[model samples]
Target: MDVKNKVVIVTGAGSGIGKAIAIHFAKHGAKVVVSDINLESAQKVVDEIVTNFGEALPIKANVAVFKEVENLVQHTVANFGKLDVIVNNAGIGPHLLRTHESTLRDWDRVISVNQTGVFYCMKVALQQFLEQGYGNIVNIASLAGLKASPNNISYSASKFAVVGMTKSAAMEYATKNIRINAVCPGYTESALLTQLINAKPEMDAILKSVIPMKRYGKAEEIADAVVWLASENTKFITGQTITLDGGTSL
Candidate 1:
């Protein structure tokens, strides 16, 4: 009952960590808005939530588009009556390639979604939050945002920007009852990771060797952190990046 009756919006919620986060909030009595680029996938999550007797709404939206993000917020407020939490969970990882080999298009694509998209969502959500006088934003950044990531130039750069944006925006709204924070997940168990491991079978061992815990973090684990951040229990916490890497960054 931590978030009971709260209206939550989760982007890229069709699958992976986004999906898990949406479900977690619903279970805790939140009215979730499942937004994703894939309409079918978003509807599936909505169907599941509805089947479970939880309130949910599905919307197909690409966060990269500011107009689309605006509509997303408007739609959520129309359906749910208000917006309490906005989880900027929609993001993409660029292909693993050395900086020199990566093209301008590659960098642009990653930045458009991972970096600029977050800004669009945050800006629109902040507008709504300011009017309401209260809001919570939990951006899903990566551990790579904290450190250098070889062969992932664009992704690293974009995520680093996300981290900086989170901190700066958090400070701007810190005293306004609007809390903005981020979660830096290391190697997490998800469909994307599965594809990565499948492409390079040796990555399995490499990950275990690098991560001190010898395991990847679960989607649900990250979801737990996100839900906690969205709750009022951490009212004193803001502008913080919770790293859930299991000592990998160390």
Candidate 2:
């Protein structure tokens, strides 16, 4: 869609790829809703967008919580007066641990936020879309969804579910004017990646080893893909997963 005047919601917009996508949408004239668990971080993004003269709203929400997700949509509609697009980008990758070594807490937290969170957001967003008869959704998945990268079972499983859910929703709404798609990224250079790198410097070499590009992806690169998916350019496209893996998944 011509994002020139669209209302878009970007969860996890406080940092990394989420922030980049929100900024791109705003730069292109969309009224963006920057929702994140960090109020200060979300506000900072809103402040930057406003500085650029783009309209945006900063909201603090934990997408994993049903109530918070509900309030998020309610508030967005109230402020923007309508809904057009939603980027289910909030996710958590589990730290390195063998399958037998992973804890229940680790599994629950990752699955709840990364998997169930997408469902909650999509559920509420679809309700609005059905009422309005139009909508777009982009779920950020990962290369792990397509292949076993070892470790990160919870994250990988959640992402795999996202891809399936995107396809199922797209088919279910094929004629209903609601589009759902996913973006599967390889290891991207962002705050999350940085943290992982700092925790284990050897991981840097290991991550690059799997990538044919021999380099990490930038947040802006992934953002570009998301904006295109959200735009009219992909109007006929749904139930698809676009991989920006720099050949890592290949």
- List CA RMSD, all candidates: 0.9, 1.0
| lDDT assessment of candidate 2 | 0.92
Give one digit per residue, the lDDT tens place, for model 2 in 53-168.
99999999998999999999999999988999999999877876878898999999999999999999999999999999999999999888888967678878888999999999
TM-score per candidate, chains pooled: 0.98, 0.98
lDDT of 1 by residue, 132-192 (tens): 9999999999999999889889999999999999999999999899999999999999876
Q: Which stretch of 10 consecutive residues in model 2 shows the poorest summed lDDT?
A: 146-155
- Once superposed on the true structure, which residue ranges of model 2 sit more than 4 Å away at CA? none
**Each model's lDDT:** 0.94, 0.92
Worst 10 residues of 1 by lDDT: 191-200
TM-score of 2: 0.98
